[model samples]
Target: MKKMPHLSFWQIWNVSFGFLGIQMGFALQSANVSRILSNLGADLHALPLFWIAAPLMGLIVQPIVGSASDRTWNRLGRRSPYILGGAIIAALAMFLMPNASIVVSIMPVLLFGLLMFALMDGSFNITMQPFRALVADMTPEEQRNVGYSTQSFLINAGAVLGSILPFLLTNSLGIANTAPEGQVPASVIWSFYIGGSALLLSVIWTVVKTKEYPPEEYAAYKGLDVKAEIDPQYKGFFGFFRLLKITPKTMIQLAVVQFFSWFALYIMWVYTTPAVSQHVWGCEIGDSASQAAQDAGDWIGILFAGYSLFAAIFSVFMSKIATKIGRKTVYSIALLIGGIAYCSTFLFEGGEMMHVNLLFTQVDVPSSAVLWMFPMIGVGIAWAAVLAMPYAILSESLPADKMGVFMGIFNFTIAGPQILSGLVAGSVLRFFFGGEAIYMLVVAGVSMFLGAISVIFVKPSKSN
Candidate 1:
C-alpha cells in the first residue's frame, strides 16, 4: 500500500478554519436560545421541550447528508457544496430565529423560533458530518490527532467570539441591552447579524481556498473507491441505513458515552440562563420584563465565552497530553474534571455572595465573574477531548468511503439523548427538583461522571 502524503500545517488549517464560523452560529444558538424563548414569553418549564425540534432535525438530516455527500462529486468538490449550502441556510436562520418576536402574535413568534432553530441545526449537521470525513480523507492515520485538535481549536475560538458578542455589544458597543416586554434586545439582534455574516464569509473562504483531492487519488489515500456499490449514488429512500447493518462495535460504545456527555451539556445550555438569573441574580422566572434578568442572561454568555476561550487556547495542549498518557486516560480525567465543575455551580450563592464585582453598564454583573471562568477550564479540557478523542478512536476501524455515513450514525447517539432530555428535563426540574436550576446542574454533573465511565469502554484502536 502506498503511504498517504502528510498535509502541512497550513493545509490542515485552511480546511479547519470554516469551523470557526460554524461554531459562531452554534455557540450563539446554545447560549441564547433559551433566553430568546423566555423573552418571547415561553414558559420556563416548557423551554426544554422547544429544543426538541433542533435535535430531531439532526437525527434525520445527518445520515442523509452523509450518504449524499459520500456519492457526490462536482466542481465544488465532495464536501464544499454542502458546506456552502449549509452556511447560507444557517445564516438566514440566524437572522430569523431571534427576530421571531417581531411577528404580531406570540404563537407565530414561537412557531417561527422553532422553525428557524430546526433549520439552523439541520444545516449545521449538513456541514459537520462532511467536515469530519474531510479530515479523515486528507490526513494519514498518525497525524489524525493533530488534524482534529486543530479543528477543535478553531471551534472553540469561534465559540469564544460568538458567545461573548452579546456582552461586548451591550457593554462595549453601546447597544441597548434590555428591550421592552415581549421584545428582543438590540444587543442580541446585532450580534446574530454579525455572526451570520461572519459565518457565511468564513465558509466561503474555505470553499475558495481549498481544493479536494480528485476521486482516484482520494480513493488511494482513503484505501477505498467511494463509488462502490455499497454507497452507490443516493439510490433509495432509506439508502444510508444499509451501513447500519455492519456498524462497528467501537462506534456503539463511543455513542453511549456521547449520550451522557451531550445530555449533560443539553441541560447546561437549556437551564444555565434560568439558573443564573433566578438563583444568582434573583430575578423572577417569568420576568422577561425585568432588565436584571436580561443582564443575567448576557453574563451567562460571558461565562460560555470564558470557557470557549479556555478551550481555544487549551485544546492543542490537551491533545499532546493525550499522546503521553493515552487518549482514553486523558479523556476520562477531563470528563471527571468537567463533572466536578458542573457540580460546583450549585455552591455559588449568587452575585450577592460573590466577593468581587465587575461592571457592564447595561446589565447587572456577577460578582464572581472571575470565579465562573475557572469551572470552564474543566469544561474546556473536556470539550477539547469531546471534540477530538471520539473521532480519533472511530476513524481507525471505519472503512474510508463509509466515514461520512458512519459519522452520521454516530450523531444518533447525541440526538437521541437530546430528544430524551427535551421530553423529560422540564418535568424532572418541576417534580423532582422543585424548579431550582442549581439542581439541574447537579444532575448534569452526575451525568458527566457517568459519561466519563462509559467512554473508558470505547473500543481501543492502534492509532489511539
Candidate 2:
C-alpha cells in the first residue's frame, strides 16, 4: 500500500472552512434566539423551556446522525451532503423564525419554527462528527493539532460575524429597529437572512473545494478491509440504547465537567439579554416602547460580539498556555476565570457601573464591553480543551472500529449538561432571586466553578 501524502496547510483550511458557516448559524441561535423569544413575549422564567428543543434535539439527533454518517458513502461525499442539507434547512428556518408573530392565531407557526431549527441543528451535528473524523483520517499524526486549530479558528471567525450581525445591520443599515409587542423587528430579520446566505455559501465552498479520501484509503489507514460485513439491524432505535449501557469511567467522570460548563453556558444564552436590559438599563419587560426593547436587542448583540472577540484572540494563545502548565491546569484556571466573569454580570445594571475600556472612540464599559472580554478569554481557553483534548484522550483509548459509536455516545455528556441547565437555571432565578435575570449569571458562575474543579480528576488515556 502507498503511504498517504501529508495535507498542505490550504488543504486543511479548505476542509475546515465549512465550520465557519456552521458556527455562524450556531452563534445566531445562541446569542439572539432568547432575546428574540423575549421580544415575542416569552417570560424570562419560561425561556429555558422554550429553548429546550435545541439540546433535546441534539441529544436525539447527534448520536443518530453520527451513527448514520459512519456508514454513509455517496457522490456528494458522506459529510458534505449533510452540510449542504443542513445549511438549506437552517436557512429556511432562519427566514421563518423572525416571522412567527405575523400569523396571529396560528400557534403551529411557533412549533414549526422550533421544528425547523431542530432539523437544521441536527443536520449540522451530522456533518460535524464526520468532519472531525475526516481530519483525523486525512492528516498525519504530527499535523493533527494544526488541522484542528484551523478548524477552530474558522469556527470562531464565523461565530464572531454571527454574534455581531444584529449590531452591524441594525446600526448601519437603519432597518426597523423596533416592532410592536410579539413581533421580531426588521433588523433582526435581515441579520438572519444574511447569516443564512453566508452559511449556505461557506459550506458549499468547502464541499466544492475539498475532497475526502476514498474508502480504500480510509480502510488502509487502519488496516481494515475496504468492504465489511453489513449489519443493517444495527441501525435501529434501540441500538443506541443498548450501546449506551456500557461507558468508560473517564467519560462518566468527565460528566461532572460537562454538566457545569453547559449549565453556565445555558444561563448565559437564556438570560444575557434580559439580564443586561433589566440589570444594567433597568428596562423591565413591557416597561417601555419597543424601541427600548430594540436597544436591548442591539446591546445584546454587541455583548455577544465582545465574547467572541475575546474568544478569537484567546484561541491563539491556548496552546502556549497549555504547554506552560499542563492542559488540565490551563482548563481549570480558565474555568475559574470564567466563573469570576459570570459573577460580574450581577454587579452592574442600567448603565456603566465599572469603567472598563474604550472601543471605536466610544465609551464601551457598560454597553457591551465590560468584563465581556475576560469571561470570553476564559471561555476561549476552555473551548480549546472542550473541542480537542477530551476527544484526543478518548480516541487514543477507544478501539478504532468503534470510534464512531463511542464518540456518538460521548456527546451525551454535552447534552446532559444542557438538559440540567435548562431544567434548573430558570427556577433558580425565579424562586431564589425573585425572577431577576441577573441572578442567572450567579448560577452560571457557580456552575463554572464546579466544572473547573472536576478537571482535577480527568485522567487522560495512558496510551497518549
Candidate 3:
C-alpha cells in the first residue's frame, strides 16, 4: 500500500473545524429538545417516543448521504457541498425549533415539533456523515488517531458553547427563563437564534479554509481504479444497497459497541431534564408550567456544559495514550468509569447525608447541581473515547473508495440503537422503573458497561 503523505497540524485542524459547528448544533438539540417537548405537553412516559425522530432520521439520511457523497464531485469538491448545504438547512431548523408553537400554529404543537426535530436531525446527519468520511479521506493511516482525537476536542469544545448558552443568557444577559403557559422561554429562543448563526459561521470557516482532494488524485493515492467509468446500471438508485452489502467486518464489530453507547446516550438526552427536575429540584412539569421546572432545565444545561468542558480538556489527550494503552483497553476503561459514574447519581442523598448512619456513605450532595457534575467527569472520558477510537480503528480497515458508505452504515449502530431506545425506553420507564427517570440513567450505566465489553471483541486493522 502507498503511504499517504502527512499534513501539518494546522491543515488537519482546518479540515476538522466543521465538526465544531455540527456538534454545537447537536449539543443544542440534545440539551434542549426534551425541555421543549415537555413544554409542549408531552408526558414523562412518552418522552422517549418524542426523541424517535432524531435517530430515525439519521438512519434514513446517513447511509444515503454517505453513498451519494462517495460518487459526487463538483466545484465544492466531494464533501464540502454536503457540509455547506447541511449546515445551512440545520441552522434554519435550529432557529425555527424554539418557535415550534408559531412555526406550526395550525397543526398540533407536538406533531409540528416532531417534524422540525426530524429536519434538524436529518440535516445534522447529512453534515456529520460526510465529516467522518472527510477525516478518512484527508488523513493518512498513521495519523488517524490524531485526526479523530482532534475532531473529538472540537466537538466537545463546541458542545461547551452550545450547552452553556441558554443558562448564560438567562442568568447573565437577563433573558427570561420562564414564559407564559405552553410557550418556549425567551432565554432558550434567543440561545437558538445565536447558536444557529454561530453554526453557520463555523461551518463556513471550514469550507473556506480547507480543500478536498480531486477525485483522480484521491483514487490514485488509495490505489482505486482511477480510470474506470461508473457502470450506468448501478449509477443513481442502486448505490446505497450495493455499498451496504460490502461493509467491512471491523465496522460490524464496532457496530455492537456503537449500539449500546448510543442507546445510553439517547436515554440521557431524552430524559435528563425531567430526571433532574423531579429527582433534584422536586418540580412537577406536566401541563402546568412552573418556574422550578424551567430553573431545573437551565441547570441541566450547566451540567451538560460541565461535562463538555471535561470532554474538551481530555479529548485530544486521548490520542497520546490510545496507542500506548491500546485503543480497545483505553476505550473500555473509559466507558467502565462512565458506567460506574452513571450508577452513582442515585447515591446523592440530597446534599446532606453525613449524619445518616443507615445509608453509610461519605458523599454529600452539598448543592443539588454540584452533585450532578460528578457523573459528567466519567461521561466526558467515555465521550472522548467513543468519538475517536472506533473511527480511528475503523478507518484503517475500510476500503478507501467506500469509506463514506461504511461510515454511514456504522452510523446505523448509533441511530438503530437510539431508535430501539425510543421503542423501548417509555415502556421500561413506566412498567419496570415505576415512572422514575433516574432508573433510566442506571440502565444507561449498565448499557455502557456492556458496550465496553463489546468493543474488546473488535480486531484492530493492519494499518494500526
Candidate 4:
C-alpha cells in the first residue's frame, strides 16, 4: 500500500477555502434570520417553529448529497461539482430571503421567507458536507487536525465579516436600520446581498484552484483494490441505513457531544436577538418594529461578530493545543468555558455603556449589552473546538471511499438535536420561563455543560 503524500499548506487551504463563503452566508442567516422573520410578522413564540426549516432541510439534504457525491466523478471532480451547484442555489436563496416582503402579493411574507430559509440552509449543507470530506480526502491522517483547524479559522473569519455587516452598514454607511411594520431593515437586506455575492465568488475560487485525485490514484492512496467493485449492500437509497448498522464506535460516542452542542447553538441562534432586546435593552416582548428592538438587533450583530473574531483567533492555536493536551481535553475545556459564558448574560443591568473597537473604528454601545462580549470570548473558544476537534477524531475511523457519505451521516447528530430544540424551545420559553428569552440561553448553557461531560466518553480509533 502506498502512503498518501502530504499536501502543502496552500493545497489544504484551497481544498477548504469554499468554507469561507459558505459560512459567510451562514453567519448572515444566523445573525439576522430571527430579525427578518419577526419583521415579516412572526410571533415570538413561533420563531422556533420557523427555524425548524434549517435543520429539517439539513436532515434531508445532507445524506442524499453525501451519498450521491460518493459515486459522482465528473470533469469538475468528485466534490467540486456539488460545491459549485450548492453555492449557486444558496446565493440565489440569500438574494430572495430578505425580499419576502416585496413579494407578499404572491404569497404570505412569512411563508416566502420560510421557504427561502429552507432552500438556503439545504444548499449550505450540500456545500458544507463535501468540504469536510474534501479535507479528509486531501490530507493524510497526521495532518487532519491542522486541515480541520485551518477550515475553522476561515469559517470564523467569514462569520466575523458576515455578522458585523448589518451593524456596519447601519452605523457607518448611513443605511436605515429600521423599516415599516412587516419589512426587513434596509441594512439587513443589503448585507444579505453582499454576503450572497461573496459566497459565489469564494466558492468559485476553491473550484478553480483545487484538484481532486482521480480514481486509480485515490484508490492507491487509500490502499484499496483499484478495480474492486463497491459492496452491493452499500448501494442506492437503503444503503445509507445499511452503512449505519456498521457505524464506527467513535462516531456513536461523538454523536452525544454533537447533540448537546448543536442544541445549545440552535437556542443561541433563535433566541439571542429577542433575549438581548427584552433583557438588556428593556424592549417589550414581540416589539420587533420598535426603535429599541431594532437597536438591540444591531447590537446582537456586533456581539456575534465579537464571538467570531475570538473564535478565529482561537482556531489558530487549536491544532497546536490539541497536539499537546489531546483533542478530548481541549474539547471538554472549551465547551465548559462556553457554558459558563452563556449563563453569564443574566448578570447585567441595561444602563451600562462601553466603547467597542471594530474594524479600526470605535463605536459607543450600551455597556450592559456590550458586556455580553466577555461571555462571547468563552463561547468563541468553544466554537473553534466544536468546528474542528470532533471531525478530526472521527475522520480517522472512516473508510476513505465512504468519507462523504459518513460525513453526511454525521449531520444527523447536528440536525437531530436542532430539530428537537426547535420543537420544544418556544414552549419552554413560554411555559417554563414566563416568556423570558434570556432564560433560554441559561438552558443552552446547561446543555453545553452536558456536552462537555459527554466528551470524556469518546474513544478515539487505535490508529489515532
Highest TM-score model number: 4
Better of 1 and 2 by TM-score: 1
* lDDT, candidate 1, at 18: 91
Q: Which ten contiguous residues of candidate 4 have the minimum total lDDT? A: 352-361
Task: Identify the leading candidate in terms of lDDT.
Answer: 4
Instruction: List candidate 2 stretches off by more than 4 Å.
Output: 1-5, 105-109, 230-235, 285-289, 320-325, 352-373, 462-464
Report RMSD for candidate 1.
Answer: 2.4
Q: Positional deviation of 83 in candidate 4, in angstroms?
A: 0.6
Q: List the residue pairs that clash in candidate 2.
A: 279-349, 280-349, 280-350, 281-350
What residue runs in model 3 are displaced by over 4 Å at the alpha carbon? 230-239, 285-288, 352-366, 462-464
Local distance difference test, candidate 3? 0.83
True-structure Cα RMSD, model 2:
3.1
Judged by lDDT against the true structure, how good is candidate 1?
Answer: 0.83
User: Across residues 1-464, which tens digit of lDDT does each residue of candidate 4 receive?
Assistant: 68999989998888888889888899999999999999999999999999999999999988888888877889999999999999999999999999999887999988999999999999998899899999988888899999999999999999999998999998888899999988999999999999999999999999999988888888888887777878999887787689999889999999999999999999999999999998888888888999889989998888898899999999999999999999999999999999999999888648765777776457666778867889999989989999999999999999877888889999999999999999999999999988899999999999999999999999998322
lDDT of 1 by residue, 98-164 (tens): 8887765656777777788889889988878888888887789888888899999999999999998
Could you estimate the TM-score for every candidate?
A: 0.95, 0.89, 0.94, 0.98
lDDT of 3 by residue, 1-464 (tens): 46677988998898889888778888988899888877877788888888999988988898889878988999889989999999999999998888888855599877887788899999999889999999899988778888898999999999988898888887777789888756788988998888788888988998898889898789877988877776554456675566567667788888998988888988888888877777776655352268767877887787787788898888767888986887888888988888887888777534432221112122222265567889999888888888888999888888777788778888888889999999999999888987778889999999999999897898866522
Q: What is the lDDT of residue 313 in candidate 1?
A: 80
lDDT of 2 by residue, 329-389 (tens): 8667778888887886665555554453334323233444354455566565555556655
Model 1 misplacement above 4 A: 105-107, 231-239, 351-364, 462-464
The alpha-carbon lDDT assigned to residue 317 of candidate 2 equals: 66
